[model samples]
Target: MIYITGDTHGPKSIGFNSVDGVLHRFNSNNFPEQKNMTKNDYVIILGDFGCIWNVDNESSSEKNVLDWLDDKSFTTLFIDGNHENFDRLYNYPEKQWHNGKVHEIRNSVLHLMRGYVFNIDNKNIFAFGGASSHDIKDGILHPKNDLKLIKRWKHDYTKQFRILNYTYWELELPTKYEMDRGINSLKCNDFDVDFILSHSPSSSTIDILGNNNYKHDILTDYLENIKNTTKYKYWFCGHMHINKKISDKEIILYEQIIRIN
Candidate 1:
């Protein structure tokens, strides 16, 4: 069985109402269906799997949340999102799984790399993860190698501008190489896959969703190209932070977990 859902910006002890800490979707009270699931069953988070955050190191608290998820019966697999700490995420050792490259986070936890097609349970699933963050207002500030900026926030700061490699990472968008690799990977697959897991929807999809707040960027444009060419059954995404069926085929998920046939 394969299930899909949205951004869990890390688990939170705050409460069930907080979107930032809404990992309870997998809990027995919320998703009792998982009790019957086995390790072979997969629960895929579209993006913004934020448990991998924390700049300096993998904090003990973060480890506890990850470890808790690992204890679940179903395997946990996530893709990188705009909220992730890319510096720490990319440092994980890379290996191949299900015909695609991945960062094995734990025995049953895996970080699916962008632009790879995996043969999961006899189904071809193309996974691409990334999107420009909508939270940036004043623009992203580059404080490369600046010790003072890392240690403390400015007293008179606007707080609108996200600090690069700190609050925000430019790596949230795919590089030219990553985009090309996606194209090449799809080409090798003959441009057909059972599904696509993405952080951002295609540019046309944004219009369909009536999301005018975000603009078209390199990542969305790239996704637009894929949308036009790829022969995919369903495209599942998470950036919009809403649960809606954009069409019969394209779906944007937030909290709802649905099993895919």
Candidate 2:
């Protein structure tokens, strides 16, 4: 069986599992259905598996998360989300996993790259993950001097001045190259897949959902094109912290977990 869920912000406890320190929501005893799952089964995270943050030198938190995931009954797979530490995630060696290329974070944890299709349990799945963080608003503003001035005005003149910066990166959006790669890969497969998994909903999908808070960008435009052109049974995504079915084919997951296949 293949199960999919929404963003899990690392080891921080959430929902009914609030008392479990440093344990992912998936690791909680509340989800007893997972206990019956075997290694052959898969639990794919929508994105923001923040356990990989500050992975340099392997802190105790990172180790604990890794060990817990590795000990799970099923393999864990995820794609990069806006909150991920790209530097640490990119350091892992690329290898093939379940008919797609991935950065193996552990024996059972895999980071699925953008623009790839995998054959899992006799089903073809297209995975692409990334999104712009709305909280940062207008990412890294221009006029560096003005930012420094603002910092100076907020504090003593003798204090060290700091420049304002964005918490989210521009790399959170897909590049032209990545879009082309995904299109070409789909073309190679005749643009057919059973599932489309992404971190953010397509621009049109967001509009249909009436989520005015999210601004459309080049990445969302590309996904819009894919939505119009691609052939897939279902498109699952996570970013907006809400659970809704935009259409018969599109689903936005936050905390809800469901079996796909």
Candidate 2: give the clashing pairs: none
The residue-by-residue lDDT of candidate 1 on 71-94, one tens digit each, is 999998998889999998988889
> In candidate 1, residue 19 scores what lDDT?
55
Best by lDDT: 1
Model 1 ranges off by over 4 Å? 13-16, 20-22, 144-159
lDDT scores for all predictions? 0.86, 0.79
lDDT of 2 by residue, 1-261 (tens): 898888887777756744322364675564667878888888888887777766245668788888888898988888888877776777888998777799988998889898889888888998898897765432344345466555544465443332222234456777888778789878877998999999988989877878667878887888898999989999999988788988899999877779999
Model 1 global lDDT (CA atoms, 0 to 1): 0.86
RMSD of 2: 4.7
Q: What is the number of residue pairs that collide in model 1?
A: 0
Span of 10 residues, lowest total lDDT, candidate 1: 13-22
Give the candidate number with the greatest TM-score.
1
How does each model score on TM-score? Answer: 0.92, 0.86
